[model samples]
Target chain A: MSSPSGVLATGSAGDTRPAPVVSIRGVSKRFATTGDDVVALTDVDLAVAPGEFVCLIGPSGCGKSTLLNLVGGLLPPTAGRVEIGGRPVTGPPSEVGMMFQKPVLLEWRTVRENVLLPVEARNGRKGAKAARGRADELLGRVGLGEFEERYPNELSGGMQQRAAICRMLIGDPDVLLLDEPFGALDELTRERLNLELAKIVSGTDKAALLVTHNIIEGVFLSDRVVVMSARPGRIVDVVDVPLPRPRCLEVVTTPEFTALVARVRELLELGHDDDGKDGDR
Target chain B: MTAPADQRHEVPAPAAPPPDTRVAWGERPSIWVRIPTWISLSGFILVLFALWYLLSSLELVSPFILPDPMDVVAELGNMANAIGTGGLLAEALGITVLESILAFAAAVVLGLGFGFLVAESDFGRIVLMPLLVAVNAAPKIVFAPIFIAALGFGISSKVALGAFIAFFPLLVDTAAGLASVDRDKATLFRSLRISRRKTFFKLQLPSALPFIFAGLKTASVLAVIGVVVGEFIGGGGGLGQQTKIAGDLLATDRVYAYGIVLAVFGYLFYAVVAYAERKIVFWQTPHGVQAGG
Candidate 1:
């Protein structure tokens, strides 16, 4: 029930615009329960161009996660179509990498083995063996090179999430789907991880879509912030962040950064008020 | 705020403190303050032995009912000598050990097969669970006479009874372990689109191993007890028959000696399974180690 505002950023809008790597058009989802069918989303449209980082943010149960799941092929949209690389997504696409809120590392496997899970699933044991060098490089980039031999239970929460990020990268996927990957960490750890994530995705051709609850986080790491409304979710605003690339944590101190954060916050409040007035009708 | 800075710097004298005999959290106590487990256990055992000896010496209980501790010890020595010479005691111990091992093997195979069925399919759970519960509810000893009558007064009947008693624990624990996989981990597998076969082999089986081992430990002890009870009811070969014969002759000391030997053998069976669990499930954190953040 979001009030429509500015024109949506379709990534296919302008004549010079590149074709989007991930495209969702007029997607809706509903869940059938014993009493009623819960409408999770309604007529949501979004696209991520190559090298663009987009974040979806809203209050709880706003279906930001539902939209992410649709793109990842974990759930099918009830109405419109979701496509990756111009093909309809019927199942988990090989070119898309996903990271969830929990690290969800297999407890019995070592750090290196956990990172290679997707590789093994796709290509079996030999493929995982051939990719060990790439796994090591990714782990080293995240400061986990020395701990590759240790099991998941031995690592701290922050370290486990870093390992999960390494896992997402190991597949060499063209698009990344992240669902609040750092939502459980402490404030300081979350900030540090945000910086790390930004650095990792900067020079890459990969298109990234992140779902988060933190306003500062959505603004800090994304090129566009997709503001969503409460249940029966729809996009209310898509704020383009004009901050320069290769950004650092110090950018938050700038007046320009403060204004963008304020803008997203305002749209979120507007959506929240619309939800209260509806009152589950 | 009214007090001068110099006066505030001076601390007030406190009253005499009460003694703190309570132990501090996570602090290791001095050897003098806490007795080791083995020492306390053995000390309590020795006290019980002393009490038995005093009661017997004072003639508080008749000799026919309560033999002296020295007499029981002498009987144990005699049995040990007989075992070394490959006599009656040795034959009985060998037979009992063989029956227990065979029964344990049968129990494990049947338990794992049925456990997997119950855990994997709705039809199996709905049809088999009530039957399993009813079988487990009945006292297994009640079936010994029937087994003896059907299978004859031989090793087969004892093993049948033992396996029937031992398999329930293994089946129940295995089903529980397989069904208890973490929800988030299952989602992770689905996200990767892992095949169902690979998921069972790579994820569910490994996670269920610790529970299987726990069941094995309990079942090992039960197997031995079941075999002995079968022998007791049917007067078949084994230490149980030996104890019955000694009791009929009013040889209380011999009965006590056989009971002690059976207790030791049962403990050995349990200990072996526990040792195997530790070796196979080495990834399990030690008792006090914190696992994840």
Candidate 2:
């Protein structure tokens, strides 16, 4: 699956004239503690083109999740700017959807109702019927058509996550931020969901930024994998996956996939060694 | 394996379990059990009547000290007749009911308003909570006399006393209910960026209903007691007035009859409040069962 010329097609160059869907310029986040200030992210400059799939991978406490939240406009940057669709993000954009590590489904609401929550919050009752129909279609796409009437508690962990994914799409947002969306599931479940998510994202025009600690997952799913360093996290390298499109589970067993995984693993270990040196200082 | 198979065939099969004759207890208990309950209650009444008859027949006690139960029953008959003559008993009962109802309404409105205000606003809670404690701690009987001195010996005094006595529970319970919303639920709303008004109405209020209703039940009973105590202190009419009249004339039988009427009124008032609580908080009843069962 390696590109002989060492470049993956990043859509046509002509289509890149429009401003990137999200642009982060020299952004840093610092949090005050009892006695010292903690730096989470530092001088992170990144841009996501329209319909791009980017995965941020790092160790625990590396602030990859913080970067995702910044782009979602859930937090204000202490030092830099984050723009979405060419507009500076002062607050959560109506066109940006977020899915947290947990499903965050309202326990009192059914699966279908949970999916419809965003639409109801944004549009009220006027668009409720259309929202319901869209929610049903999304649920079907996520392989949960028969479980729409069931409550979150009645669903398995994987199914609950699927419902949450449907909810994220219900608003028809242009940008989707996923914070370790499959990090809680077992190995088999996470693998199955990764395949399903690839298909789902490929079918939509939304630009997705996934935060994960899994190296294989980053290679298997993202168009470009952004490897980040430890605390005061900054992007260390951007590795473009040259694997062919329409990837399946079989792709993970190939020699090309193993080499990409090895490269990410070395970068992550290098991030850890750098952190070790900083701790000593 | 051959021996085991032969033994299985040799074993005598049990009879067909009597065609599973036993049936489940019906969805509800049978009428026969209910009939006996009624009959046993009537038997209790008969026993009381026989005791009354035996005591009166033997003249076992002084008439002034222990009026025969039959005499009280007869007084009740006369009381019914007095209802037609001047409608005295009915009028007193009407006034008592009216006073109780008015006091209950006033207590509920004021208590719920103050409770929610205190629960919702930190400043209001800090300032008003101490004042409420002071008011609740004072002897309500003192308020009864003061109410009479200020409002005069009329229905207003009784109503005031009832309202005063009933407000504390309503305030306490309503505040507790409002304060008891789950913090996790609040965080969920915050994460969603739900509006504050929507959070209060949809999440907090519905969750607080059971606690508020509990306070109402306690306040209703207190309201009845308040009215009776107020009447006992100074009142122109009601069962308390009749008690004073019977005491003055040394009509013990008539006094007992009034006491019985007061007991029935108290029971009825409590029952009505309980019934309303069940109706308004019906979701709690079924939801609790599903959670714990």
- Against the correct fold, how does model 2 do in TM-score? 0.65
Query: DockQ of each model against the real complex?
Result: 0.21, 0.06
Q: In model 2, where do residues sit more than 4 Å from their true spots? A: A1-19, A32-40, A55-65, A101-114, A143-163, A180-198, A211-221, A224-281, B1-104, B119-122, B129-195, B207-293
Report RMSD (Å) for each prediction in the order shown. 8.1, 10.6
Question: Highest lDDT, which number?
Answer: 1
TM-score of each: 0.88, 0.65
lDDT of 1 at A187: 80
Q: Residue by residue across B1-293, what tens digits does model 2's lDDT show? A: 01111111111234354432333533555555557777878888899888877886688977776788888999888878877776878888778889888889889988899889889998769999998889899887887878999999889989898999998889988888888877635543544566878877766776687888888888888888898888888876977887878878999998888888877887888888889878766555532211100
Per-residue lDDT of B270 in model 1:
90
Least lDDT summed over 10 consecutive residues: which range in candidate 2 chain A? A1-10
Predicted candidate 1 versus true structure: per-residue lDDT over B21-135, tens digit per residue: 4554546677745888889888889999999999999999998888998999999999999999999889998889999998899899878888898899897699998899898
Error of 1 at A222 (Å): 0.8
Model 1 spans with C-alpha error above 4 angstroms: A1-16, A274-281, B1-36, B61-66, B286-293
